[model samples]
Target: MVESLASPWRHDFPQLLENPQLHYLDSAATALKPSAVVEASRRVLSEDYGPIHRGLYPAAERATDAYEAARSTLHRFLGGREDDCLVFTRSATESLNLLAEGWLQSVLVPGDEVWVTTLEHHANYLPWKRVCERVGATLRVVPLNTDQTIDATQFDDLHPRVKLVAITAVSNVLGVALPVSEIAARAHAVGALVVVDAAQAIGHQRIDLATWGCDAVVASAHKMSGPTGIGVLLARRSVLECTEPLLVGGGMVDLATAEQPVWAALPSKLEAGSPNLVGAVAMAAAADYLSDAGIDRVESHVAALTHSASEALAQLRGVSVLALDAPERDHGIVSFNLDGVHPHDVGQIAGELGVAVRAGHHCCQPLMQALGVDATVRASFALYNDDTDVDALVSAVENVIDVFGVR
Candidate 1:
C-alpha cells in the first residue's frame, strides 16, 4: 500500500504554505516556524516590547510577565518541577558552555572522568574536552557500534570516577535516537551526573526530563520552530546550586556593593545582561504550539517520513543509507552517501532541483570520521513535512547519481 502521508499541519508554516514547490528537507538544521510563533514574536517586537524584571513601568511589567511565562511554559514543556532551574542562552552551544564553565568546571576534580561519545555534535564534545583540559579531568570518548548505537563493551564497568556523561538525544548525522533514560540510569547508578544536548530532539520527541533523569538539558529555540538568537538551559536545582554564573551583568545581580557583591537567585545569577526577551516569548509560543499539536503525533509523523525516505534512498544504486538496518534507531533524519559523488555535489544538485537538504558533516566531523566518510547528505524532516517532500528528495538523489554517472 502506498502511504498517503500528508502532514495535516503543513499549512502551519508560512514558508511552506506559500511555496508548494520548495521542498525543505533541512529541518534538522533548523525547523520552520509556525504562524502562531511568528505572530507571537511580532507582537513582542512591536507591541509588547519592554525591559523585564527590573522595570516598574507598564511595558516593563508586561515584558517581565511574558518572559517569565515563557519560562513557566518551558518548565512544563520539559516536565520540570518547581526545583528545576531554566536559564535562557544564545544557543544550545552557549548552554553547553555555561554548564561546562558554571557547573562542570566547578565540580570536576583533576582526576575525575567526563564521558562523551563519538556521536556527539561538536557543541557537546568540544565543551567537555576543553573543560577536562582546564580542570585536568580525563575525557573518555565511547565509540559507536555498526548500527550507530553506543558500544556496550565500553561500559563494562560503570565507575564512580565518571563525574559527568555528556551526550546528545539524537545523533545529528545518523539521526539515531539513543537510549538516554538507560544511559542516565547507568550514570546515576555510579553516582554520576548526565547532561543531555537535546537540540535536535526538542520538537520531534516529547522530552520528560525527570523521566530521563538528566541533571541538565540544553536546547535552542530556532531548532524547535521558534525565533533565532535564543536557547535554553534546564537543570535540576542541585546542579544549579553547584553551578556558578557563566556571565554576570545587570539583570543577574542580587545586590551590588562597593566593597563586596551579592549574587542573585538561581536562574537570574546564571542569566546576566539583557536576554533575548522577544525570542524567549516566541519560543514559549513555539512550546505551546508543539504542546497543542502533541509531541507523540509529531514523533510518529517524522518517524514514518524518515523510514519511507530511508527505504527509498537505500533502493538507489550506489547509495548507502547510514544506519539503514536500524531505521527505528533514528528520528526525523536520514543520512546517506552516494558511492562516487561528493556530498557537496549531491547537495548542490539537490538544491538546484528545488529540494533543500544539508550536504556536509552536519557539524559532526568526529562522527563522520567514525563512519569513515568525509561527509554525507542529510535529509531531515519536520512535523510539517510529508511524503511529497520525500519524493522530491528521492528524485534529487537520483539526479545526483545520474549527473555523476555512478549507476
Candidate 2:
C-alpha cells in the first residue's frame, strides 16, 4: 500500500486548521474551500467586482474581463478547442437540465431512447427521464457489473434507437472511475451524442474534452473547492448553435421584436439573466490551486488514502465496503455499510467523533436498489486529507460497531 503519512498541502484549508479534530471525508459531496479559493471569493464580492457584458464604465469593463477570463481559463483547463462552446450556469444540475430541455427535447421522439447508467446521481438521471417522458422517448438504464463497476463494453453500439448516452466519469458511491473515453468512442461509432457528468471528476481527475470525444459535459464548482451556485456547460459549437437556451432574458438577446427574438451568439445566448460573478472567479482560482498542487500528485495521494481506508474497513468483520475488489479503482472515496447498522446511525455517530462522512442513498436510489440496500456511508478524500484522517474514520467506524454491537 502506498501511503502518505502527512499531506503537504493540508495547511491551505483554514477549516482544518481551525478545528484540528475535524476529519472531513465527505469531499465527494463538496470539498472544503482552501484559503486561496476563499480569498478569491472574498475579493470578488467585497472588491474588484463589476457588471459583466453591461455598462460602459471602467468597473464594468474589468468585471467583463474577469468573467470572460475565468471562462477562458476553464476552457484551457478542459483542453477545449476553439470550436467548443463554454457557458456558465447555476450548477451542474442546471447544465444537465438545459441539455435535456434545450437539446434533447427537440430531437427526442416516440420510440427513440436516451441512455443513462444506474450509477447516476438523480441530477443526471431525473432531468433526462422527465424530458424523455414528455417527448414519448424511453429512458434506458445501462446496468452495472456484479461488482457494481461500469463496464465499457455495455455501451452496445448496435442499438440504433439510442440518441444519447449520458454517463459519469466517476461513480460517487463506488469510487470506480469508468472508462468514459472508451465509452464515448463506442457511442460515437453509432453516431450517438455523449454527455459526461464531471461533477465528481472535476477536482479528482484531469479532463480533456477533445480526447473524451463527448458532445458535451457538465460540472459543479463547489464539488471542486470553489464557491457554490455556479457550474459550467461545455459543448461543441454544433450543440451550441442547434440547441435553444432554457432561460431567456437580458444578456442573451441580440435583438427582440414583436414577432420573434434574435438570440446572441455562443455563450452569451446560453447564459441568461445576471451571472454569478464571484463564483466564476473563485472556481478559476480553485482550478489554479489544483494545478499548482499537481493533479497527478493529488490523484496519487488520495488513492493511497482511499486504499488504506478500504483495506482497513474490509478487515473489520461487520463492515462491507461498496467498492470494486480492484484496488486500482480506489479514487478518493470509500462507501460502505456496516452489518445491521443504519447508515444514518453510522453517519451520526461518525460526526459526533468529528469524522464527517456522507450517509443515505447519496441521491442514487437506483444504484442503491441495484446494490440491494437503501443507503450507505460514504467517506471521500481530497488533497487536504492524510493518513491521520483515515485513522480517525476507522476509529469512528469501530466506535459505531461497539455502540451497535454488530457482529
Candidate 3:
C-alpha cells in the first residue's frame, strides 16, 4: 500500500468523515460541502429567511443585506473590482447560456466566427453552438495537442472575423490547464471577446478576473464546495453594460411602459425573479472557508495528490491514463480506461467497492471522440480528499480487473 497523504483541513468537511466507508473521487462533478457552508445556508433558511429587494420588513432588510454582502464577498474572492459586474445564476451552465443568448446571439452576425477548444464541457460548447446556429455565425474548434492540451501554436486560426473565444480554464475530462492569459491576449489582439469557463478551476486555483484579462468568467458554486443552486458570472463593467438580459421580469426592469421598457442596472438586469438568497449566503461562506484555508496551499496539496495518484495508477497493467506524460500539470483530475473492460463496468465495480468515481463522456462527447474512446473513468480530487482516497480508488480498480479476469 502507498503511504497516504493526510489532508490538513479534512475536518472542515463533515461529509468526508461521516461516511467512513465511501471514498469519494468525483469532485470534478461536484465537491462535498464544508460544515461552515452548510451552517450558513441553514441559518438563512431558519433564522434570516425573507425575500430580498421586495419588502421593507426587518427580515427583508436583513435578507437583502446578506444577499448583497454575499455578492461583495464573491467580488473580493474573485479579485473583482465592482460588485455589479458579478451576476448570480443557477449554475455555470446558466451563466454561459446567459452570455450566449443575451450577448453573443444579439451581437453575432452572419459570417462571424466563435472559436472554442475541443476540451470544453457541454456547458461551454452547446451554448455557443446553438447561438452560432441561430445567428448564422460559424463555430470554429481549436484542436488539442498529443498531450491533450490546447495547441497554442494553432491559435493563429483566431482571425479578425472571430467575435469571441470561449474556452475552459481546466478540462473536466483531461484536466489539462489551458493558458488562459495567453489565449486572452491572442483573442484580444484579434478584437475578440474571451469568455473562460472556470467551473473546474475555481476551487483549485486562484481566480483574478482583473488580471486574467478575460472579458467574462463563469463557475458553479457546487463545484467549489458551495450550494448547488447558485453560480457566478464575472465580467467587466463595460461588458455587463452591453449584455442584453436573457430573462426579463419584475426585478430586472427599472420601468415597463406599454411603449418602451427600461431595464435595471448591471446585475439586477440579469437577475430576473426572486434570487437564490440562501444559496448566495452559503456560497459566500464557502468562499470564506476556502480563502481562510489559503488557495495556494489548497492547490499545492491537491497537485501533490494528483501527481501521486497518477503515478500509482500508471504502474498498473492494462490501465491507460490520459495525459500521463504531464501528470504534474493536471488540475487534480485523473482519467483513464481499463483495457478489455468497459468504462461503465469499471465504474460499477469501483462503486460496489465503496469508491465513488465518475465514468463516461463527462459532458465532453466531442473530447471523447477526439480521444478515440466513448468514455473514461475519471477520478477527481478536492481539498477534502487525501492519499487514502487514492489508495482506495486504485485498489478498487484492481478489484475490477480481478473480477473481470483481465490479464
Candidate 4:
C-alpha cells in the first residue's frame, strides 16, 4: 500500500454546490478544476486577454509567450525529446481526427491495416475507420480477453502489412490500463506505428513519450483538471513532418500565394488558427499545480479510492465492478451496474442525494455491450475525494438499490 500524501489544494476547490456531504465521483467524464486553474483562466479572460501568435500588440505578445510556455510545460511533462512536436487541437476527438486525416493518409496505402482495439473510445476508433474508408485500407480490431484486458494472443495476428496500431492507455469505461509500451514494441516489430489515446492516462500515471516510442499520442486537458476545448497531439518530429495538414489556416502557414502555399514547420504546422491561448495558459497552471502536489502521491491517493470503491461495490448484491482483473488497473475510476436497475436511475438517485455520478454509455458503447449491459453508473475519483466522499457514495448507491428493490 502506498502512503497517504496530503493535497493542500484540495480544500481550495469551490466544492461544487457546497453541501457538507457532497460526494463528487464523476471525474472520468470531466474533472473538477482546482482553484488555481479556474482563477488562471479568469485572470487571463478578464484582466489580461489577448489574441496570440498573430498580433504585435503588447497583450498579444504576452499571451503568445504564456501560451507557448504551456506547450513547453506539456513537452516537459510528457518528457518529450527535442525531436517531438506537440500539436494543439480542440479535444481528444479532434486530435485523433487531425492524425487520421493527416498522418495516416500520408503513410497508409492500399491493403495496409491499422490495428485498433474493441475497447477504444469512438474518438480513437472512428477517425482510423475513416482513414481506412478513404485510403482503401483495413481496420483490424484487437480483441479483449474475458478479463477485459487486451488479449495478448492476438499479437501473432499483427504483421508487416499493419501500418499502425492504435490503442487507449486506459479504457474510459473499464478503467483498465493497457500494456502500452509492450503493445507499442510489438507493433514496431511488424514495422507498424503506434498511436495511444492517453486522455485518461496523464494525471493517473506518468507518461514518457520518448521511452514509449509510439508514433503519436493524444490527451485532453479538461479530463486532467484543466479547462476544456484544448487537447494535445504528441508526435515525433519525423512522423509529424510526413503528416499532411487537415486544416489549412493562418498560423500553420509560412508563406501563402495563389499558386502554392507552404506550411510552417512541425508543431506550428498542426495549429492552424489563433490557438486557445487562455486555455493553454490555464492548462499549464493546472499542470504546475499537479506537479507541486506530486503525481505519484496523487496516483497513490486515487488507487486507495479505486480499491476501496471496487471492493465496496463488489460486496453489494447483484452489482458487478468493472476492471477488477488487473491490480495495476487501479486508477480513479469505478464503473459498475446494479441488477434490475437502470444506470440512469442510479445516477439520478445519487444526484438527488448530493452525490454526483455518471450514467449511460460512457462513450464506449461497444465495451458496454460486451459487458452485457446497456450502460453503467461510473464513480470516478480524484485527489480531492476522501474516505467521507467514498462512504457517501457507497451509502447513496445502497439507498438507490433499496429504493429500486434490487437485490
Off by over 4 Å in 4: 1-9, 16-19, 151-153
Instruction: Kindly provide the TM-score of model 3 when superposed on the true structure, using C-alpha atoms.
Output: 0.97
Candidate 4 lDDT tens digits, 1-407: 22343444568678653655677888888888888998989988887778887779998888888888899998888768888888888888888998898888888899999999878998988999998989999998777787778854566678999999999888888778788888888888989988889888776667777788787888899888898999888888888888888889888888887478888987888888888988788878878878888888888888888888788878888788886776566777888988888889999989999899999988887777777788989988888887777777888888987898886
Mark the 10 consecutive residues where model 2 has the least summed lDDT. Answer: 322-331
Q: lDDT of each model, Cα atoms only?
A: 0.88, 0.89, 0.89, 0.83
User: Clashing residue pairs in candidate 3, if any?
Assistant: none
Model 2: per-residue lDDT, tens digit, 16-118? 9999999999999999999999998888777778889887998888888889889998887776888998899999999999999999999888999988999
- The runs of at least 3 residues in candidate 1 whose Cα sits more than 4 Å from the true structure, single-residue gaps closed, are 151-156
Task: List model 1 lDDT by residue over 154-176, tens digit each.
Answer: 66567999999888898888888
Q: Give the TM-score of candidate 2.
A: 0.97
Model 4 lDDT, full chain set: 0.83
Query: Using Cα atoms with residue i matched to residue i, what is each candidate's TM-score against the true structure?
Result: 0.97, 0.97, 0.97, 0.95
TM-score of 1: 0.97
Q: How far out, in Å, is residue 76 in model 4?
A: 0.7
Better of 2 and 4 by lDDT: 2
